[model samples]
Target: MSGYFVTKGSKFKGRPLTTLPVVLNQDLSRIINSNLQLKSSHDLEHLRSVAQQTDEWTKLTVRIREAAEASQSEH
Candidate 1:
């Protein structure tokens, strides 16, 4: 728990635990690589564009709430 903040030139119990080994070999590697390959969504809606639109709407909503609060306070 407390012994997990990574730093350079660090060793653990002896064998340099700073770098973790990723075992991507043989059939496992081929299957993983095939599955991990990027493919576009079926509906033609990209995640990045949807995310940007959601962010813009959230910001506008926050601004509208703040303006309403300010008007109430002034009255």
Candidate 2:
């Protein structure tokens, strides 16, 4: 292993955000995205203005067999 790296805003709350891929076909994905935006009031207004919203969409996958927090550099 090399070294550990944590983002500026990340705090050691004894846990981290993670996910198990929730695959959705285009139809299902669109439903989820629309509902999220509607509920958030399309709160991500900057994203709405863009022509293509591919970046706004999360591809939904992360694969890491193991990771260790060797150390943390605090902000």
Candidate 3:
């Protein structure tokens, strides 16, 4: 239920690019201590590399909720 997401490279429309979706999971420090080398092959890749300490992740969660509400209102 809790994991990270890595997206793939973009698609082409004419001369522009589009977004793609891909997911990958690396070994967490709680799981492994070795350094990881990831290849660049995506237009967008999101990672939850660091563990949230206190209210750090909370701010992001709140911002996301606010954005969602704003989007809903725009519709």
RMSD of each: 18.5, 16.6, 11.8
Ranking by TM-score: 3, 1, 2
The candidate that achieves the highest TM-score relative to the unseen native structure: 3
Candidate 1 lDDT over residue span 1-75, tens digit each: 112223437354665433211221121223322322112232123323433798854654465466556667988
User: Positional deviation of 36 in candidate 2, in angstroms?
Assistant: 2.0
Give the better candidate number (1 or 3) by lDDT.
1
- lDDT tens digits, residue span 1-75, model 2: 011222357465865534221222222233432432212223334334432555444432110111111112221
Per-model lDDT: 0.37, 0.29, 0.35
Cα deviation in Å at residue 20, candidate 1?
56
- Estimate, for each residue in 1-75, the C-alpha lDDT of model 3 and write its tens digit: 122123436653685322222212221111233232223422113223322434644654454456556667989
Candidate 3 shows a clash count of: 2
Error of 1 at 40 (Å): 35
